[model samples]
Target: MSTPRYALYYAPAADSPLWHFGCATLGYDAFTGEDIAFAAPAGCNADRWPQLTAEPRRYGFHATLKAPFELAHGRSEGQLRAFAHQIAAGLSAVPLAGLAIAALGRFIALTPAGPSPALQTLAFDIVQAFEPFRAPLGAADLARRLASPLTPAQRAYLEAYGYPYVGDDFRFHMTLTGSLPQDDVAGTTAALGQAYAAAVPAAPAVIDRLALFRQDSREGRFRLLDSFMLGR
Candidate 1:
């Protein structure tokens, strides 16, 4: 069997309205590993919403902190969990003005309304602190990553960190859909934006916890293992 893969991610508190909204939009709850009813936003049809969300549903609702990785040869899940706790303990929550639905390239996601220096530092620190636990990308994975066009800096990051989006290339976003047809982007974004504003509280969004998600196999959906409260 393929070794399980784990990811460090930022997710809203499971009991919060934002969490329910995100999970319902994607039609899957990673916390429970169960499919849920689709909460299609105003402009999207039910049939199309599922197809649009197919990709993110597999990984669950989250902003990537550290992308998925297999454990290093000498590392174990217990050790990773302990290390994650230590990292979270030292980090305070990051606050954002709010999130806005935006189209990133060809995909839809919720992005911060304003940049947060503290958030950037937290993400970078997680990437660095968790490096010891990540196995180097396999030959096939490395080749696949190289197949994508990358700037020199991104290429360097991929070689060093197993993911290209780090440092200046990183943007925190909770994905809402897979790549979309050019015609669909604007409408989808507008509709989801409306739904998001209605569903999510207007208060500032806080990155208060870090969640650990695990995928049992390449084809499997990632499930939440646990969450560590920041600075607790």
Candidate 2:
């Protein structure tokens, strides 16, 4: 049996419009651990929708803060939970102008419309503050990460944090689809942009809470474990 892994993420409140839009688009509700049907955008292929979104569906809908990691030898889930609460209590919310649908590499996601120094600092701080709870990456995991082409800095970060995209290498994104074929990128982006506009409300986005997510097994979908409001 595979051991459970945990991650820190920023998921909008369950009742919020952005949360509903993301969960609907992915066809899975991380909070409820249930599947919800989503209509394909007018010009998109409904039949291919599942294939395009299969990967992100597993993770559900959230912007990753601390990438998934197994608990360290001495850490218990209770300790981790208390730590998350402590960390959240001292941090203020990070506000954004809003989110924009954008293509990142081959996948599409909701990205911040503009940069926020506070958001970046928050991400980095969590990565370091939670380091003690993260076990070292296994050999197979390390090999898989190294297989990708990474800059010297990213490789260094992988060695240190077990995730290459932390610190300065991180770009906050709530993934909307799996990597698409080069030929499908343009059309997919257009369809996703339109769908996003229709589904999500017009409001400034804020990172107001930190959610703890758990994956029961290697093949299992992640689900919401708990959420702690910031500055509470």
Candidate whose TM-score is highest: 1
lDDT of 2 by residue, 89-125 (tens): 9999999999999999999999999998899999999
Q: How much is 175 displaced in model 2, in angstroms?
A: 0.3
Candidate 1 ranges beyond 4 A from true positions: none
Clashing pairs for predicted structure model 2, backbone only = none
Write model 1 residue lDDT over 1-232, tens digit each, in one string.
8999999999888899999999999999999999999999976888888998999998999999999999999999999999888889999998899888999999999999998888888898999999999999999999999999999999999988999999888999999999999998999899998998899878788899999999999899999999999998
Model 2, TM vs. native: 0.98
CA lDDT of every candidate: 0.93, 0.93
Judged by lDDT, which candidate is best? 1
Model 2's alpha-carbon lDDT is 0.93
lDDT of 2 at 58: 96
Per-prediction backbone clash count: 0, 0
